[model samples]
Target chain A: MEVTEDIIREVEKGNRKITLDLYHYSFNVLMSSAVRYKNHKEDQMEIVNNAFVKIVKNIKTYRPGTAYFSWIKTIVKRELIDDFRKNKKYKELFKIRDSDSVQESVVEPEVYESMDSESALQMLNVLPPATKLVFNLYAIEGYKSKEIVEELNISYETVKWHIKQARKKLKSLIIENKISLKQ
Target chain B: MKEEKDHIDDFFKERSEQSSFEVPDSFLDDINSKLDVLDQKKKRRGGFFWLWTLIPIGLIMMYVLWPEDIEINKTKPIVSLENQETNAEGALMDSMDEQKSESILISDSLTEENITQEKPLNDTENRSAEKLKSLKNVLQDDVKKIDKLADENNPLWLKEEIKKQEVFNSSNSNNESEIVPPEVEEMAIADSNPEKNIETRNSNINATENAEIEGSETDFAIDENVNNVVVSVDSLGNSESEDSIINNEAFEIDSVQIDSLPTETEDQDSTLNVEEVDPSETMLAGGNREKGDKINHEIQLYGGVLNSSSNLILSNDSSTFPMNTMESNLWSASFGVMYRAKIKQLDLGAGLSWMKTGEKANYGTNTLEMAEVDSLIFIGWQTDSVFNQNTETWSIDSIPLYDTTTVTTYTNDSIFYNTANKYTWISIPLRFGYRIDVNEFSFIPRVGIDLSFATGSNTGTYAEIINEGLTQNSSSRFILSYALQLEVRRSFDRWHVFVNPYFRTNVTPVISSAIQIRRYNSWGINAGIGFKLK
Candidate 1:
């Protein structure tokens, strides 16, 4: 379902019915941002639902004619960051590990090309917590090393190293599986 | 290798854009439940917020509308008597020395009607005035005895004075008369015996000296009481006979004129000019009063130069350098206006400032090598023929054997240049300051955070590698900093001049550009003037 201005207006006017419709429509976008960092589906759902509640509460701050998806994505990212800061267990995941170097052999292009997004995501999930987050930000979210440095307060070399490590692990995961039938 | 990396990044970026995972059916239900709880909490919080906000406002309104009549009779009457002692010729001697003592005698019947029109007494004030009236009667009786004693022709005055004291004692025992001031009672007792009157007068002088030492508050009260009696007489019509002075105009106090009769003479005609005393000034004359108002708000304008210390991050990759400018000097400057509102001893303030930090710096020297092309080299010797004008025959003379050849020589030179690099920031500082005052000077210490935004910037020359066509790029547009400040202020009436010395440092780098990252911590002294707003 597409979100119309009428539905947005209804949600802003405290209509719970239209709010549910808006939630279902924007669910996939919210989940996409929440899914990368959280390991459990329940925690991912929590971050998305909290972000949705914030969007509904502060709906008046939403400027018209701007990209609604970008705004929603920003909120979801902020919710993820807040979760990271509050949860002390995330500190263990953020510790920089002495990762092995990338192998000399590169994975053939056909293997990556034939890979389904579900399998690709599974391959990406196998990377270390920090490496997975850095790769998602650098490749999927299109963030520069400098922006990642500012966001994570990490060194430029650390961000570059994580990206390299994530690529190496994902390539190895793909080579181990070779080509699999689409589920 | 770069292309291979780009390929995987492109694939993931596309996948992330095109793919959407299935959301569980219960996700929407969960959001609805949270939304309902949030709505309930918001409603409760909104109600509480209004309730809390209106309470103080309601209290303030009630206080503002309350009546002023509750403050009735709070201030006492202000009065000062210039006692006039008249001689036999009736010339009034306007000297305090001529008066017998500083002790004031209150009239026995100074009621609401007996007061002057300028100061009308309420019913409560009149009750206290009437109590003072009873004391006046005792003083009046004593004045009569003194007047009778002044008759030196009566050689039997001593016997008559004794007989009157006995009568006064009998009246005091019978009617229970109002208590007279101790000094007045002593005067009456001393005058009864003419032989020891001089010795008793010396004792009264000693008592006056004791009153002065005790403090001025007592002196002010006694002076005002005595002036009230004179004012009461003046309120009525001035007359020669004691009866006319008592029975003249608006109100009558019994025997009020008898107290004035000692100074009254037949030839005296000048009426006393009543001096109105200010109660507030009289209280200050005691020198023991609290200050009336404290300054609650102030706005100051200040500006100064500072010495800055900064760490610069430079990159070696000259191709993709974001910022082309770097500052070599450490001098910076800033100026701004601030407004402070005091809550008791602590003050909270916010200010807007413009701070400039970077300066022109030398980029580097550029050396260029060029080949010098114009050179003649000797290769081999050759004969040259020359003809003499007089010989008419061809003659060959060897001037010099030379051949033209190309030779390359290198020239080395360097060109030096500097670029103007400046960074301007519009900053807002929120601070908590405490003021300590000593005499006319005050020292205030402040600590707070500063939030700044880079509004303007220009590129400067830096290092040996110069990238052409690259503009200045600010790494971070916003920066948070902290500062410590101490203000030394000298007050002059409503306006004050102050010198504020401060130290500030950015929590994050203000400019985190690719080539050069600059973060500045500076110390500065600012001087300016401020006015008391309230």
Candidate 2:
């Protein structure tokens, strides 16, 4: 199940059992990509399944010397973007819209101290698809506004708006969840 | 805990933490199972590829071998007419030769009862002469009533003469006796056979008997002059009495025919005799150029294989599907060659075709932000389902000040997703249309209903191939469609090369519901040759 030259070769040859084994072994390595690009309310399991199918389909085109996990991550990102682009929910996210004073809700780091990473992910899942994507890109992936605009094909201001909205939604989710925990 | 106000930007910049969520237990198994199912489809399509070749070829061979005009040519003798006959005597000899070999049935009648051949026609003796004289006297008396043989050039006159000569030769073998009786001999043959007149009377009695008699023996006696008695059997007289029937041969033998009539049974008698059977119009039904010419009907058979071009109406107004669809080379082909007849300038025809056709389009609901929305955009897809937004207010008084806040709830409206819509239809088309052959090509525009009995894919207005594989559309539906068929034909002897372009449209929608309606319209061209099996 190790990501090796022979394993990659067998997967490329369309050995179904080997493909399944490789998928199981590489689950943890691929999970982050699936989570990062996953849209709000979309099933992470379904995304993983779609990503695995695409991986197997493109196995023949995979370069042996290249980083296998990166290749898989790239496919996962594409699948998520495609999933968002195809749906009617998030198509307008990158378009030019009114850039005005957004309602901002900021929280202190002390609130996140007691919060588990699982809780953080669940909170991130509540943001609208474009806002979530922009937040992941700007905060986690560390892409600048211009890079985000070029990569996501969005106006610079739209990306900033998404970042702001994402923070507000994340703050709200954290506050609501913390209150619920206290209750 | 007292909350500290920090910019949302600082909160985002502060975190670079990994998230942990438990993946589903059977997640790997689910992907593998789906992969297996999708893989099976690829295999099945591959398997059908070879069948595509063999199936159409087998169908073409079957169509080529089917009997189209076979029955028309069966009765014509294999022997050449020139070799068989030179003059009137030779013609009689030919008819006699046919009758001798065929042993045509004249069942339970005159020759069946009274005219017993003590010996064959070869037995030219005194007793045979006496018998012939007696039979001749009786036959002439009956035939005397049919005196229309007054014209020597007439075909009926010749039938009458041949009948008398055969009777004479059966009675005695003399070359001079063969030449002697022209009209008188026919009168003798016609008049002498009282039982033949009686049998004719019986066939005349009913419509059923008329069909039976035509089936039994409707041979219009062909003479040496090739003059044929086109039997006006009803003209002969349907009366039960022999006297009235005898009187009716006044319209005597008007039509002419030589090919053997297809009777159900044959008489065992080896002598050549005119079969006195019923009368119906059997002139044209027999297969031959001669029989065909008399009827004024010509058969035109065409066989062609065509590839069709069709499209799926993905959206009501081509929003998802623009005029130029990013299409692959996915098309369908059909082979069906029909038979048409030229009735002067107008041609009428019908044909059966085996068609495997489909319409495919990839349609997705692109996220449409009415005003570039970031807040959960809630709006109805249509006019009717407007979401009811209800608001309630709560107020909290702090530091001797009162503040009010509003909470609004919005209804859920359905959103569209990206779907790869694909539908495959296998239909059997039964088409009837009018064809016009101008110069080398014929245009046949047909209107008929096609039965789409087997299919797979999306059942909506169009098939949507979503990010998730193809939608299952398995149920069969009837589609009304029309075809503007163009054919280029080159005929060689009895064979021809037919290239028909099959263009068809569905008048009815491929998928229709209360909200949406879609149609499968296509234009395709197929090229193949076919044979005429006559």
Candidate 3:
């Protein structure tokens, strides 16, 4: 069902019944954003629920005529990051430099043609959590490096370094998968 | 290279957006249930705020209403003595009046009879009577001096004077009774009921002689005095044979009591000294004050780190957990306020603490085979009566329904998730401890029971039962646990600092859900500052 202005108004007024409808409407977008940070479906579901809880709590602050999907996506991403920060092990990995060197050889564009999103996501998991998060925010989510730096509270050099490490790891994974597929 | 990068980024973004996954039917129900829980938590938070606010007020009211200890010191003993006298004076005066009336009755009867059979004996009896009268005067003077010394708060001097008076009273009464003339005894026996007159005189004399003993020994003295009186009566060779036999028995009992007097006097002396302290006097003012009398309240503020490990046990024997399930120990922190009261070497206390404890679990992916049960409805033929308008008769028709049950098996791959399950609780611990002091430091070993309320929890992954579709977690709001600790403390005037090492475990499993039961056991150390409220 399409969401209208009247539904948004009722939801903003703490109508929990309408808020559930909103949950169903935005389930896909929330799941996709949650999956970038969490590897498990259960944790992703948890992140989505937490995001809806925030959206319902602060719906009144949303400006009308703005893109509602973008607004909800921002809330979901924030929830994902918050959940990630709860794990101290992941937080510690955010500062460590990846020891594996990036091979300078570039992959042919045809190599990526048959690769699906599930395999790509699995390949992305090989990178450290901080590098994966930075790459997803910058390369896929279209967030600028400066915006990433401000959100993550990291220096520009650190942001560039993580993206570089993420690219190298993804390239290595793609080449390995191609070789295995050929075999 | 730049063009290839753009194409690669665009392809990855498109694949991610196009990727689709199915949501389970139970997913919506789970979200709604979580929303309801969040709503309830919001309401409870408001109630908890007011509850927390009222707790300190209730404590203050208890402190205000506590009974105060009364102090009795050397300079203030007169005040304490006055209180005792004011409470006991009416009872004492009433008993004294009864004794005086009875004694006067016996004396009047005795004075009416004059024995003039032997002049020298009469002279000796007269001199002895004068001596008895002089002794009575001395007893009365001693009583007056006791009252005066008691008003002056001189317990030592008063105690010595009482001992001197009792010795004189005891020895004089014995000598005076033995010297009574034979004619006087004959006059006593010539009364209408000789036994009754003799018994009355004996009781009167004993009351006067044992006045001090009665005041100190109470019921014990009464038995001894009765026996002594009966012994004197037996010496008279009364006409009644039964009375003579009874007096002989009394003489034997009196002899035993007379022999036990010195041992009994030492015991009674100790009792008298304790009675002098008076129950109304506080320990601080009493000469036998101890360390416990100095402090009434000790408040401690503390913080500590807990290394918690969770043990998960299967809830049912139907299925065992998968081999890949793993948990790692997690670290959390707690802080609390504790109030204790010291009585001698024992410390009793209760405290409120907020603590977080949980573990990180990794449930790796696996192929799970689940069984589902489904019911199928079939239409069965049955006979039914139908009304026929024309024939006015019933016809049989067939209509039927039956249920059939079937089980279906499905194999699916379980999702992998690593969850850091954190649970927060507000705990109230009731503690008991014994303090042992060594040099400048005190070591206190304590044990306690904690009543904890689960304020909230953050959890993502759960161990699920194969066919039941159930997850393991706690649904109950309260958890009970036991704790043991030892505190090493160093004192600085009214303030002190301490480091406490402690171990705590849930008495019962804290988490019992569909799949498994979980118990949390933790080891921790806390350091805190304490202040005495005296």
Model 2 chain A is weakest, by summed lDDT over 10 consecutive residues, at A96-105
Docking class of 2: incorrect
TM-score on alpha carbons, each prediction: 0.40, 0.40, 0.39
lDDT of 2 at B96: 29
True contacts kept of each: 0.51, 0.29, 0.40
Q: lDDT values of the candidates?
A: 0.58, 0.47, 0.61
> What lDDT does candidate 3 reach at residue B494?
83
Model 2, B79-128: lDDT tens per residue? 11111111232222222222221121211112311233334444455555
> Candidate 3 chain B: worst 10 consecutive residues by lDDT?
B229-238
Q: What is the TM-score of chain B alone in each candidate?
A: 0.36, 0.37, 0.46
Can you list the residue pairs that collide in candidate 3?
A: none
lDDT rank order: 3, 1, 2
DockQ of all candidate complexes: 0.24, 0.17, 0.16
Ten contiguous residues with the weakest lDDT in model 1 chain B = B84-93
Q: Rank the candidates by DockQ, best first.
A: 1, 2, 3
After superposition, the stretches of candidate 2 with alpha carbons farther than 4 Å from their true spots are A1-15, A37-42, A54-75, A78-130, A137-159, A165-183, B1-24, B40-55, B65-534
Better of 1 and 3 by TM-score: 1
Q: Each candidate: RMSD to true structure? A: 22.4, 17.4, 25.1
